[model samples]
Target: MSRGPKKRTLEVEEIISLYKKGESTTRIAELANVSSRYINKLLLKHNVERRPRGHWKRKYHFNEDYFKTWSGTMAYILGLFTADGFISQQGQTVSIAQKEKDILEEIKRELKTTQPLYRNKSTGVYMLYMHSKKMKDDLMNLHGLNPCKSNNVEFPYVPQEYLHHFVRGYFDGDGSINFKGYTIVFVGGSYLFMDTLQRILNDKLNIDTNLVTDKTNYRLFLSGRKTIQVFAQWIYKDKNLFLERKYLEFMKEKTPLDLLEDRKFRNTKNAVKLRKQKFLEQLTKTNCIEKASSLIGITTNTSKQWLENDSDLKEKVNILLNNNK
Candidate 1:
């Protein structure tokens, strides 16, 4: 027998409505002009489960139109999503889980979703899941993502400038670091997915790595201290969000402007000029640009580009060609 101010039937229904809709007791009480304790009693009397401390503050839904944009944050989240996100075939539900809640927190913030991160009691994995047909359709129609995406997922198109953010997000999701062995590795189920990623990375970063079959899945490994260090610098460049523990693991051996000297020496004007001189010397010896480029371990297109871009090189090459004739 709870003895309190007896509310009208309408008010009680409205209070229940608010409670069901995730309104906090204090807020509901304030809205209803009732005491917090009275609101709690009312909710309990009606058999509504009490939320945990601060749980009511969580938004149970996400921004439905979040995946429609192409920002860096969106790209990164998409990358993370591509790595570990799952789509349920039964409905328009998508979920991403992580061992570290920090990355999930970052994803939530980026998606502008306050959706509660639920933890599995058995596996201890924190997952942020949402049910939105529009979002799921966008993911499928726009990115070609589907249910049971583990084995057949394809690499989605990412803009060139946001490539690092995307790959960093993917790394945070599916990549690992071997501190003692000095290796950076990425695991994936599809061979094409791994191969496409490898080609992009190799073309862009000049990273030499091994792409091999790892039992069922495939792995791309960038081994050795120099390769891993360069990769860390490349991926972590101007990054705002990443798995902090992984970032810290890479940071343990890094210095301020770690690759400054290497970049300086390699990018010096004198170095380019000297290289051009060496190419011209090779051109004089070989006569054919392709042959000369091969002799100097440069590409024929590079030799052609240098000749096109440098008038001095063009004149010297003409002189060498006339001599060869």
Candidate 2:
């Protein structure tokens, strides 16, 4: 015989109420003797959302105060990195003091114009103010940190010397070159200087050597290993003509009076005389001798006599000719 008509199922609202009141879907389904799928379908049909059991909702929200604090702290860290002598703009050197001063001024200017908005209800303005204070403290701590002092500190203006020491230190530390051997290191600022030194030392001094300059770094080496300072002084005193030309180029970028500040050039008659002659020769080569000598500080005729009498200059010319083949 056919069974009586099936009983109608309970409405979705009733199922949802039971579920909200902590009744399991399985228990509800059993009580109604309906499939669990039907219970789930009914709940969805009524637009009831079911969250996973035992999951906790997030208790915190990010506010403007938190963002400002974090941003300010990050800014301070960036400022510190700059102040601590980061290489920038194709390795052009900048001092820590200069970077620090610039950042401090910028921060002060920003603070003057910036206005805070949307404070945290629980933390209030204290969180924001504390962040600012923390930034200041961090900057102060960075300022107190001493800069890494190098042996070439006495000659800050001489970039060649700075580069030389750096290279030497790097090589010595890395065991790339032995300092104790019968080794000659050609040091200079530009490739021209270093190249010239390499040739001159090879020809004149007959020394076995390596040319340590910036070019090597670009092609094969790493940073913080250039020692142009010791190399420059060595070349000047030892009368390395290749290095002398490099020094001349370096000096040409500066005034004669400024060049005189270098003890290697200033203390020696030969260095001073060689520099003056090289200056005139460079001017003559560039067709600027007439205009250059017209300046109040320069004496072209005296420079000529110095060049004529320079033994080192004569030797360099002879060496160049010999190596020309």
Best prediction by TM-score: 1
lDDT of each: 0.75, 0.35
Tell me the number of clashing residue pairs for each predicted model: 0, 15
Best by lDDT: 1
TM-scores, in order shown? Answer: 0.61, 0.16
Q: Write the per-residue lDDT of candidate 2 for residues 3-52, one digit (tens) a residue.
A: 87545345555568655644456545653557667777777778877858
Position 217, candidate 1: lDDT: 81
Structure candidate 1, residue pairs in collision: none
RMSD of each: 20.5, 27.1
lDDT of 1 by residue, 85-198 (tens): 877665456778899998898788877777677665546778777767788998998987888678888888777888888899899999998665466779899887888999
lDDT of 2 at 114: 33
- Residue 31 accuracy (lDDT) in model 2: 39
